[model samples]
Target: MTEVLETTSGSSPRTRMNKRILTLAATGIGAAGIAFVVAGAIVFGDFGIAPDFSARLAAPSWAHWFGTDQFGHDMFARTVHGLNVSLWVGLIAATLSAFIALGLSVFATTCGRWADMLVSFLVDATMGLPHLVLLILISFALGGGTHAVIVAVATTHWPRLTRVLRAEILQLRHADFIVVSRRLGKSWWYIGRHHFLPHLLPQLLVGLVLLFPHAILHEAGLTFIGFGLEPTKPAIGVLLADSMRYLTAGNWWLGLYPGLSLLLLVLCFDAIGNGLRLLQDPRQAHR
Candidate 1:
């Protein structure tokens, strides 16, 4: 009788490969769009190589990859520029929000009651308002523009991150490692910097990734409503708003392309976030 042997193989390699592919696809598409935007902005100006308003709307052709808008602006160029705007808004807003939340969470965890109440009250108040309305109000109050939009988005986005980090810190504070660290005569500040911060990083990273999509959409919405970047500027929201004008005249490319791009960008970030969440949990990964 032939001897039969069972072999075991680790799933690590497969997992890594999947992760690599996911990263490549997400990063490649996003980066290509970003590079296109940047090149357009630097080399061809914000609206790309669009013609004047006199050209009328044109369909996609070799001469015009994505065609021209009513103003004869290249739709492709405008879309690319919009990508830059969204990317910056999302990235900056997420970073600023994360930092603000981190500060608040650290204060709450270290300073105890006073910090906790202040942070809680602030977050609660912000949460009680309609987020978009608040964004609009903030934008208007700050003299609505690109910088104002970034500030407004960051201000509103941070509170939830603060709450999440606070919860995570509270849970980790009672962990065995933390308890042992305390017993070793380590100061709170020292423990937080060396021990607590490390534990909190993964959760914060996940939150930041998820928060980006919201920031991007919020910026777009604000822009769409005339409370965001300048209309003359090449922003996705502006492109979207402009598209509506020509949509009834069979110029569907104006609206449909940018909308699709926005949808795909948001979906990509969301997918990456979900993937990261699953990667963090072995059970979820297996499932």
Candidate 2:
């Protein structure tokens, strides 16, 4: 029994150490991939729009890596530029959604029971509708621009994170510290600023990170369906939409490159979120 206990204790630390290292590595890789895309976007933004009609429909080569589309634009340049634009849109939408979640969570938890019920109903009603359909309708109503995509995604994505934060806030509401603060005559704002925000920070951060991939994918989907970003811009959806024409003509790179890049971007953002979540959880073994 003594030997077993010693071995178990020794191995536990080793396992946790291994987990920490792997989590950090995953986060680092995700950050590096994002940075590379951001840098590529800066370098290739002009190339994406500069049509070289002379090289139209050229196959992938040393001169035009990733090939030239029928419009004579470089696939590699457009892929990078589109991804960066998608990144910015996702970042803006996700940030707005996070703020919305935080605000609603606070209102539901701090307000009377009726307020909580009302917020819950709203969340459910919003969530019950098809997410894509809601996005399309909202975007169309706003006349379909980059701003419209941001607004649509921002509004649609909040309910989920709001639900998560609401649960957290509810639990926090009953905590001894919060109760004590109220007894001492602290205002709700004071208690929240001093107590609730600290505990909620981790969940908020993780939710925001996880929200990125969803926002990006939805924006791309909206654009692909003719209602997100403008077709003239170098959006991944625009690239993919244009690629469809050449895909059946034996030009596979047009579709393959942008789609694959978007997939990789989403995967990397997801990895970052998951890594942050695992690292923050003390019970790493269970995960």
Candidate 3:
């Protein structure tokens, strides 16, 4: 009877296989993403800034996988180094954005009604504006560098996460456990540190992970438009911008490989985030 029950349960063989596939897919993608970033770091440290003028505008070959740019720099090396820069910028910006969202959400939920209203108003106002326009304006105003790009992306990307977290915290604030803690003379800080923070961890992590791709893309966009890292910097946006001039001369490899690499990296992050979201759901356990 036990054997029969096991065979008939929701965790069937097919379901288990599917779950395994999903888990493997997620793990593989996440690992690949990390490995790509690590490879970029290694390449940046070892081969960065080693341009050869003799090989200028060379086509892709075994010796130069991604071909050579106008400066005769190895596109493979530059792309990898550029990837490292993009990853660093993305990570820092996403982390800052998440913290900003967390702080605003906490304040809105714990302070007072007026605080909540003010936060809501601010979030709405920020969201109402054109995101790219605001980012460009902020980056331009800040003098168009790495620090400026990071600040612009961080400040502009927090509103959506802030809204979600604020709603979650508002719901949790009136929970019976929270009320009990309040009645027991626990201060808001104490309750928040012990109760609210633990519950917010998953949401915070998800939001941070999801923000990575956006941050990377925006940083690249700003750089491409001459408002991000300087042209001397080996960044993805800079690479793309430089590739534009050679494209009309039929040197497509200059842009093709780097662009594809950026797209692949973004997709990997998206996959990792989606996988995490799915894993967090209990209903997915049997599937």
Please state the error at residue 196 of candidate 1 in Å: 1.5
Candidate 3 ranges beyond 4 A from true positions: 1-13, 16-20, 43-48
lDDT-superior candidate, 1 or 3: 3
Residues 182-279 of candidate 1 have per-residue lDDT tens digits of 89998777877887788788778889988989999999999999999988788999998988888898998889888888887787677667767666
Rank list by TM-score: 2, 3, 1
**Which residue pairs in candidate 2 have backbone atoms (N, alpha carbon, C) closer than 3 angstroms, thus clashing?**
none
Which candidate leads the pack in TM-score?
Answer: 2
Q: Rate the local accuracy (lDDT) of all candidates.
A: 0.82, 0.90, 0.88
TM-score of 3: 0.91
How many clashing residue pairs are found in candidate 2? 0
Least lDDT summed over 10 consecutive residues: which range in candidate 1? 1-10
Model 2: what TM-score? 0.93
Candidate 2 weakest ten by summed lDDT: 278-287
Using lDDT as the measure, which candidate wins? 2
lDDT per residue for candidate 2 within 124-170, as digits (tens), equals 99999999999999999999999999999999999989999889888
Residue 283 CA displacement from its true place in model 3, Å: 3.3
| Candidate 3 clashes between residue pairs 3 or more apart in a chain or in different chains | none
Candidate 2, lDDT over the whole model: 0.90
